[model samples]
Every structure is written in C-alpha cells, then in structure tokens.
Target: MGDETTHIEQAGPTELRDPLVRTEIKRAAVWIGMTLAVLAVIVLAQPLLLILGGLVFASILDGGTRLLGRVLPIGRGWRLAIVTLAAVAFIVGTIWLAGVQLSGQAAAFSATVTAQANSMLAWAGTHGFTPGEVQMDQIGQQLMGGLGRLTSAVSSALGAITSLFMIMIIGLFIAVEPRLYERGVAWMLPLRSRDRFYRTTSRMGYTLRRLMAGRLIGMAVEGVGTWFLLWLGGVPMAALLGLLTGILAFLPNIGAIISGVLIILVGFSAGVDAGLWAIAVYVIVQMVDGYLIVPYVARKTVDLAPALVLGAQLLFGALFGILGLALADPIIAMAKAALQQNADERSGGKAAAEP
Candidate 1:
C-alpha cells in the first residue's frame, strides 16, 4: 500500500486531475447534456405536451381562484373548488341544454360548407376561371379528402374524453398546492440557480394568469356577442358558429380566419343580406377584441408579437399536433417572461459591476 501510494505520487496528475482539462471536460459535458435534452424533448413530445397542457389548466384554475379571493373572502381551497365546480356546471349545462340541437346543426353546417364550396367552384368555372371539368372534380376531391383526414384525426385525439380527464386531474393536483411542486423543482436545481429559477417561474405564472384572463374574457364576449347577433339576424347554426368561434378564439390568428370563413360560408347560404350581416358581426366582434381586450391584456402581461406567435403556433402545431397549437400562445408567453427576466438580471449585474 505504501509502495502504491509512493508510485502514484511520483506519477503526478492525470489529464482529469489538471484544472484546465477538468474545466474543458465540464464544458463538453454541458454540451452533451444539452444535446441529450433536445433529443429527449423530441422523443417525448406527446407526454411533455400533455404535462404542459396540465400546467396551463392549472394556471387557469389558479387565476380564477385568485380572482374569487378578491370578492369571496374564502379559503384558497374553497375558492378553487368553487371555480372548478362552476366550470364543470357550465359545461354540463351547456351540453344538456343544447347538445341535440347543436349536433343537428353541426351536420347541417358540414353539408352547407360543402355545397358552398361546390357553388363557388361552379361560379368560377362559369366566369371562365377554370374550364376543365376534370380539374375541378380533382380539386374538390382533394379538398374533401384533406378535410376528412383532419376531422378524423382531431376527433380521435383532441376529442378524447380520457385525455381531457387526465389533464384536469393533473391540473387539480398541481393547483391544490402549487408551491409544493415549485419547491420540488427548485430543489433539483443547483443552489445558486434556485433563486433565479424561482424568479423566472414567478414571472411565468403571473404572465400566464394575465394572458389566460384576457383570452377567457375575449372568448366569452366573442361567443355570446356572435350568437346573439347572428340569431337576431336569422342566421342558421348561430349557436354552433358562436361556439366554434369562441373555442377558436383561444388560438389567436388562425382561429379568427377559420371562424370567419365558416361564418361567411354559412351566412351566404341564407342570402346575400345575411352574408353581409355575418361579415358585419365578425368585424364588430374582432374590433372589440383587438382594440380592447388585447391592449388591456398586453398592459398587464407580456405582449407577444403577432408574427412570432403565429410562427410558434405553426411550428408547435406541426411538431406536436392540436394540443401544441392550442398551447403555443401560453408557452410563448412564459418563455418571453423568462427571457425578459434573464435580461433584467444581466443588465442589473452589469450596472452593479460598473460602479
């Protein structure tokens, strides 16, 4: 043993024992770790997205609970319970009251949309825009085929009651005692990073709450306003259109374009006047949301650029499907908040160092 120790001492430090080499090794490890992280995210995209969906849901519940606290003077648990129960009741009541009617309208709406598409194609052909009958038939077939595939995929995945139930359960567990999870995550981080992590998470949570508040409010206003106005104007499937519009509102730019197309198509089926009226309603609702709700939300939260959000939506949707599309806004907002906080810290550090 003494001879071995003597031999080791005489042999001197190895590469890993050298300080510079150790530092380089650490740097390489970091790069490797980052590469692995990226790979993991790609491979586990679906489960990660589901977890994110749960977090988003928790943010909504947390926001509602806080809002109720201002008025109800109740315990957090009680407030959360109230909010959850209210949401469940609203969903159940809406379905119970209008399920059959809406189902019938949905089928009719699909037929109406197809008929309108054929009518448009026919009109275009008459105007000498496309004279080939075979081409028109092919185009129509392709459009219908794409729509069928999209509808089937969405119904099978996004409409899965089990997925939604799992999300709600996850959200409730997190919302019940969020700090526990927050601290648990922080515990996994290095001591020096925990404070920064906490700050970033706090900012993210605040941004999410404000962003969701605006989105929910906008959805309610647009849905109800569209329904009431369209119904008053004798538009068929007003309820279904309004419902679609409200849900789509959650998706920002893409949602608006889709809902508008549906509204215009359905509106024209009734008459030219009704079609024009639908356009007017769409304009008014959008104007209210864009000028009012968006600006108010921007002031309180991170104001994401439209193009950036759209790009993120497209990327996420393509990568992770519908849930990613629905979540792109919130994810972008949280990322923005974290980045902004990091910038602030760096600026502050520079300022401190300058003196």
Candidate 2:
C-alpha cells in the first residue's frame, strides 16, 4: 500500500515532465494569472486611476517646464517652480477678481437652464408628444436622481480638496525626478525587457508631450475667442461662458456640446438676436477649432479617430467617472504609442532573422 501511494505521487511528476503536459500546465497558469489580475484591477481601480491622474498632471507640468526651458535657459527645477507658481497665481488672481461675479452668475445660470428646460418640455407637449403626465414626471424625477447620484459619486471619489492635493503632490514628486521612478519600474521587470520597456516609454512620453501641447493651445484659443466674440456681441454671462468653454474644451466632443447648449440657453434668455449671435459665435469657434486647430494638432501628434476617442471616453467615464473621462484621450494616445512601438520592434526582429 505504501509503495502504491508513492508510485501514484511519482506518476504525477512523471506526467508533468512530458512536453504536452508541461505546456498544458503553463497555459492553465497563464489563465489563472490573468483572472487574478482582472480581479485585482477591479478591486484597486480607484487607486490605479488616481495614480494615472497624477501621471497625467505630471506630464502637463513637465511639458510646461520643457517649453519654458527653451526660452528661459534656466535649470529645470527653477523652470518647473516658475511654471507652478504662475499657475497658482493665475488661479488665485482670477478668483480674487471675479469670485463674487462668478458665484452670482452660477446661481442665475442654474435657474435659467431649469426654466429653458421646462419651456422646451411645454413646447414639445403642445406639439402633441405622446408621453402622459405620470410618465413625464417619472422621467424628470429619474433624470434628477441620476444627476444627484453622479454628482455624489464624483465628489466622493475626488474628495474635493484632499484628492486634488494628493494628485498635485504626487505630480510634483514625479515631475521633480521622473527618471528615478522610470528606473525603479524598469528594475522590477525582467532584464531582457528593460530595453524595450524604456524605448516604449520614451515614445509614450514624446507623444503625450506633443498631444498636451496641442490641447493646451486649443483650449486657450477656444476660450479666449469665445469670450471676446460673445462679449462683443453683448451676450450675457460672457465671462462665465468663456471660462466654461475653455475648461470644457479640455474634454473634446461632449464638452463642446455641453458648453454650446449653455451658451444658447443663456443667449435666448436675453433675446432672439442674442441667441442668433450666440449660435454664430459657437459655429465660428467650432469651425476654427475643428478645421484649423485639430488638423494641425493631429499632424503633430497621434491622429486619433473621433469615434475611437468618443468610445473610450464613454467607457472610461462609465467605469471611472469624470476623472476617467478627462484622462481617456491621454490613456488612449499612450496605449497607441506603445502598441506602435511594439509592432515596430517585432517587424525589425523578423527582418533581422530572415535569410
């Protein structure tokens, strides 16, 4: 009985020694590892996203620092400090100057939007829409509830000041000595992979820098242009609209839609002429951005498809909320750069191996 038990144990190892059995075991291990990885990602999604946000913020700061370096001819640290301080000063000054105006306008803007929405619903009802009063009430309630949930979730995840502070600190540290972190990450990888990893990362960084530069330029142009044109046309809440437009411009398709809707609603609240002017301003601004800014930027950076970016934005927004929405483009651009680098490497290797 003892010998039989020993034989059975030995048989297992003997089977494992066979090439086919070994391959099967390896496959099973891979599957198990992948499943575990997925589970871990699900559990740690928030922390992972925050880290990614930090990286994105770091990239923006790094980009500015590099740009400043060209003209300033100063140390990177000093340049970075100047850039950071300038950003802080701008925010503080803006708030100090227009805090009260913005606060009042924000409240009025909310009321105007609500009134316009009700007006539209009434107009639709007059056109003989089929929905009953109960259904309409339920829809309105559901929409408000959904918005409440979304806002609450975003606030909790962001933790407002705390999350912002953490992200800024993380960004500052990484920006201060990015190479240290890079090397640290590379050290954890297999020796053979370090070179490829470095190469891929280099590509990703270059793409990100270029992409962010274009986006910054686009935001500035759209924001400033919209503000000036709307103000010239005597549009109400020009400053608020401009600020919102500029911030939203950071987001792409959805941002434009949202800002445009706000502009139109506010414009109509004033008068028909104001509304028409608002429409004209929106059209002109979008045209400039879409035709001139976007094409130029696409040429310099990764030429992402609109559909692909929108799809990613939706997916990331659903999974990770507003932060994810903000980050979707950068993440996609980096991923594309990495994939391209990998494909190039594979092609080069194949070419080298051919007779």
Alpha-carbon RMSD, each predicted model: 5.7, 4.9
Tell me the tens digit of each residue's lDDT in model 2 across 1-355: 3455433444455586778789888999999999999999867766777788788778888989998988999899999999888766765565554566698888888788777766766777777773533333556677445432333335663474465666777888888999999999999999999988888888888788788888888899988999999999999989888988988998989889889988898888899999999999999999999999999988877899999999898887776667777889999999998888888898885111100
Number of the predicted model whose lDDT against the real structure is largest:
1
Off by over 4 Å in 1: 1-28, 93-99, 125-159, 349-355
Instruction: TM-score for candidate 2, please give it.
Output: 0.87
lDDT of 1 by residue, 45-137 (tens): 767877898898899999999999999997999999999898768766666545665878888998998788678878888888877443435
Clashing pairs in 1: none
- Model 1 residue 283 CA deviation (Å) reads 0.8
Candidate 2 regions exceeding 4 Å error are: 1-10, 13-25, 91-100, 133-153, 156-158, 349-355
The 10-residue segment of model 1 with minimum total lDDT is 146-155
TM-scores for every candidate against the unseen true structure: 0.85, 0.87
Residue 86 lDDT, candidate 1, scale 0-100: 84
